[model samples]
Target: MSNFDIRDLLDHAAAAEPAQPAPASADEKEPRLSPLAERMAALPVRPTYSPVIITGAARLADIAVVLATGYAALAIYIAPNHGYPLSYLGLLPVFALATVAALQAAGLYHIGAMRSVLTQAFRVLASWSVIFLLALAALFFTKTSEEYSRVWLLGWYVSGLAGLFLVRLALGLAVTRLTRAGRLDRRTVIVGGGEAAERLIEALAAQRDTGVRICGFFDDRSDDRSPNVLAGYPKLGTVDDLVTFARRTQVDLIIFTLPITAEARILQMLRKLWVLPTDIRLAAHMSQLRLRPRAYSYIGSVPVLDVFDKPIADWDLVLKWLFDKLVGTILLVLLSPLLLLTALAVKLDSPGPVLFRQKRYGFNNELIEVFKFRSMYVDQSDATAARLVTKGDPRVTRVGRIIRKTSLDELPQLFNVVLKGNLSLVGPRPHALHAKAENRLYDKVVDGYFARHKVKPGITGWAQINGWRGETDTEEKIQRRVEHDLFYIENWSVLFDLVILLKTPLALLKSENAY
Candidate 1:
């Protein structure tokens, strides 16, 4: 106020401004949250290294193997009085290997089964016990009865069974603890903001061992249109932000809580998010769609309409794998002489290795090397499968034609099922990487074509027995095969697999469709 210079007086007046008026009131101000709370409120989130189906599957597999091996070893060691000094050590490894292999096939080592620890443990105990009894029966049949004492066998069985149970219990406890800590959970994000999203969140949170953890809601609306906070969760950003967040975060699931009536929006969202390696589900709880109850899966009694489900889920795949390896091994052993003759014939007829290896698309679009009995001449073997194998082709050797037409050439794939873990005994038959029908890719031709690959492709399948085998030159032929594949996937059971396996020999007799 006392400034003497004219310039100084003017500068003071210029620098002065009306105060910001203290931002009205706290309630009127926008909600400010702490970084951690902000993150939680804005969640439909995942951690960087979240657990997945493969990880859970592997853990269960390891647990089963460890229990099987450790129990056998411990039992042998504990029963010192009934066996020859060190000769029984060899039997321990053999039993462990056989029991583990059998258990794996028995569906005792599946990730879904692992969740029900008691049930899985009982299954493990039953499988190993049966295998042990079978070993005894084999010894008796071979008249090697006096080699081991009965006392040793009984003691071993008791100790091994107890040890198996204890190991499973410990594993179950550890898995539960980790799951509670959010280490072994599926991180989920809600795609809509409003009342429906709120209720879905509440329902999901109420379930114990449900395995879904909601991160946050994403909606493209202003504050008045979509509340800043809905059902205790904040509206993080927009649909664009959801895409960005999904990429940045460790999200494993995206649940669209929007109504199913928004078909165009749903399809658009799917097109945008489908390429991500996460699951995309459309919440159909609020919808009036009159769908089958089986079409809906529950989360603590809260119904969610399934847009997509896990393929080859639970213990079915485990048993299928087991049957393949077991039967494949037996066949390999029994048919050794025939295999030798085939090998000799192939070597004499063609200038190539006894087994011809070619790359084919396996489960999940993974490239796998398939084995054949060298049906094509060395110079003409197509590595990329650019051309289809037609009847009476020049590339086919004299013996090759006979073996291929007779379906004997595919016997080598039994080894693929056993050793490579690429093929199964019963399922959809795999097509070539460049396989086409009606001038379009097999995947492109069908709506959920790739979904058939949820389980491993088989050497012989339901389609093969139903006359859908061999060259799929016509659209009708391929469509029939795909239909059979889908039917198999939808109604898969161990008995269904067994029936297909039994019918395979009969199917092979009708090789009219074979190339």
Candidate 2:
């Protein structure tokens, strides 16, 4: 693999034209910018909470089509003569599962497959044929072939094929439309502006169907060493500037072109880049050392080593969202009485709204309004938490002290989990954007503090259950809290979330740090 020719990575015929002279930097001169780039820049650099994975909407759509076709086939053959078969109803889910799995195995759902209408139709036919054959073989093996109607089976098979084809046709058109609208392309940036970066750019440009849009490059080198323009791409800024640029732009992937031999420099750059919620890849096309194929992920045949992947990507995101909504709704219903009573007590004890909304650093460092039952006098409310709520603070109302201590004040955030979908039931606890410790911001107290926000903020997190909750009067307190948050992100799992949730109530009972 190390000896793989670099020339094979690029399509010489389609290579990008020599880059034009470098335009003035955005900061140095008024440069004309694309409307999309301009809008992204003007937007506040908040943590974007978008599902980074391919929207499962398409997958779900395909599943629905499979299910619908199966039922339609059953109805077409059975309903006219003997009515719907009760046994067939149970078989629908199994068939749908099998069909989806087959399609997945055949790579029909891949982004590349969606680019061509003909290719999608062909794959659909092939996958559907496999499902039909499997179903027939199962029937034959079970000796149940004689029990079912041959006419019904034949009609169902024909109808299912047509249905699958039509669905793929519609999906192909939709993909085309979305791609044209710039909704389907991955926003990519190159990290080094040298020969390696140029080669990767040319490779990506040749495969336009790969859906990678190389916006620009970010390098620390000077123009004389690393030209301002590389293979029709300009250097946006330096390595540090890449962080700010990434925050401003909807950058999805950052490809590092620096050779792997520069381990110290690469590690230093990664320390800065990993904080942003984006995939970081080290280009390996020019590397001398070869590793197993499993070690590298490909971006259109060009091998790159994965440095850091955005956590809970693709289908995992969908699963987590479903978990949050299902549990959040159940919790809201089960605890409605306590929630109502808490609202009333807060209303009677304090002259403020039942719920208090405070701006907190949410997923990707975006400011989200986290809801909580009001626990302070209306006039003395510290929205920013500029003053940490100390024990026996006079500003805390009578009911506020009890709620804050017991964590009942946090109940309203269930709405944030179920309704707004911003906060998860388990993750790092969201802190007020201006939350401080000894007059220093939490980020200043800890390295990679912003990295914790890569996942959504939660009502109860690892930090709280680990006894790192409450006032961060000392720097160590905040440091420990961040430490726990990062650990939770790295070691996240559904079982882990359940464990945290189970431990949270007991932790609350202790309330050693609660104000």
Candidate 3:
């Protein structure tokens, strides 16, 4: 729609595309993904802390200071013994809440503010003073001045301020250490080189503590056009290389220094870059084109077009991980009897291993071994999934048929969801390495196939619940599955996951395609 923003348009454009580039075919001399993997492996993997986690910790720290000091002040000065009554206890919470609200309103919890001791102290003192002023106002209105001691209120205010400074001093030292180690800062990689990138880099650097640490540049131009090194950072590689690099390590932000007017290059870059789970920003500072102010978010003073954002990121990632761990463990415990019975069934029916471990594409297109109860005979086990198992297929044992039909064979992947930390309880289903439909590899049959991996694969998924489970015997079947997968990814939430999970039992009843 014309009214939609550029980011929304770019995001949907790739998914709507009929076809996109696929990895090199088997006939090619060198495979595409192997080299990408090798290149990624060569790069050092660095730790990255989520901004949400950092900001949340800062908020908790503020609340802890106010609440702890409020209690201490109450205990020290006529807290209960001479409080005129037990009424002062109620006011402690109000005072603590007021101080925290004041500090939040002052924006003292922002990443930029957290990095600076002077900034935090000045802001904290101002906010604390304002709260105390308000508390005095409340006390005057309530005529409770005669009831509580002035020393108590003053001590609470001063002690709260001191607590804030002490806590933040420790946080400040930690921030400095994290900054030095590239943990706290957003590890950024500029996608374009030249004066535009140099200008952007200089602008960020000028701000000193912009909270973004430039990792380097990734440009498509030749060395003459775009030098190997620019603005004191090396040109790591091209946009294609950037994707591989991101898979290897944590790349928090991807900024395109190229002006917005370079639509073709921007779109091209986006086609490849959209698959990454990182913030993608198109720097629009030099572009003559402008949209409403709300359309852009700034990095320091540089204006940037908000493009694709990583899905299930920050707190959502944390929450999903927690949910998987908690729920998966419970489910695993509750179903231990069933799992044991199934394992015994598989062992008795077929002389193969009780569990099957097949490599499947996981989050960020990385291979994660998925566990399943062995559903095929030992000699005929299709590890690569090169052939589709059909109805009355000879390889399918009697127990395998029942488990596969009932979907109990996938229960062991609870380990993947719980212990391994690679799979989610509900997400796009990860496919075997050589999974194919209609004799064509999934990547070749569908455009943007790997895009489904933007989130961790799950044992159950939107596609599975929507009649897209079981065999993918045709290209159309896989396409529909991928479509459902992308839809689930775009609209994911805890509630959505719960709904899909609840509907799974009913969906499993119609196992006509399960074989």
Question: lDDT scores for all predictions?
Answer: 0.68, 0.78, 0.81
lDDT score for candidate 1 against the true structure: 0.68
Clashing residue pairs for model 2: 47-364, 47-365, 47-366
lDDT of 1 by residue, 1-515 (tens): 01122233224334322111122245531223323323433444323223344444554554455456545544565445544345565576676667667666866554345556788677877876887789889889989867766766776677666766665666566665565556656667788877788888888777675677665567765646466556655555666555545544465677888888888987776655543445677787787786888887765566776565545544654566678889878877887788888989999886769998878767655578888898888889887666777777798889988888788888888888889889987878878777777667776677556566656788888899998887777778888898898788778888888899889889888888776
User: Against the true structure, what is each candidate's TM-score?
Assistant: 0.57, 0.83, 0.87
The model with the greater TM-score, 1 or 3, is 3
Best first by TM-score, ranked = 3, 2, 1
What local lDDT does model 2 show for residue 60? 69
Clashes by residue pair, model 3: none
Q: Candidate 3 residues 1-515, lDDT tens each?
A: 01112233233333331111236777853223333223333545556677578778777877787878877887777746765346777786787677778878988766666778888889888988888887788889999878777888888888888998897787777777777676667778898889999888888988965668776677878646687557766565678867877776677899998876688989988998888878898888778887888888988777888898889988888889988999899999999999999999889986879999898889987878999999999899998888888999999999999999999999999999889998999999989988889889998899788889899999899999989999999999999999999999899999998898889999999999898
lDDT score at residue 39, model 3, on the 0-100 scale = 35
Answer with 2 or 3, whichever has the higher lDDT.
3
Error of 1 at 172 (Å): 5.5
For all candidates, the clash counts are 6, 3, 0
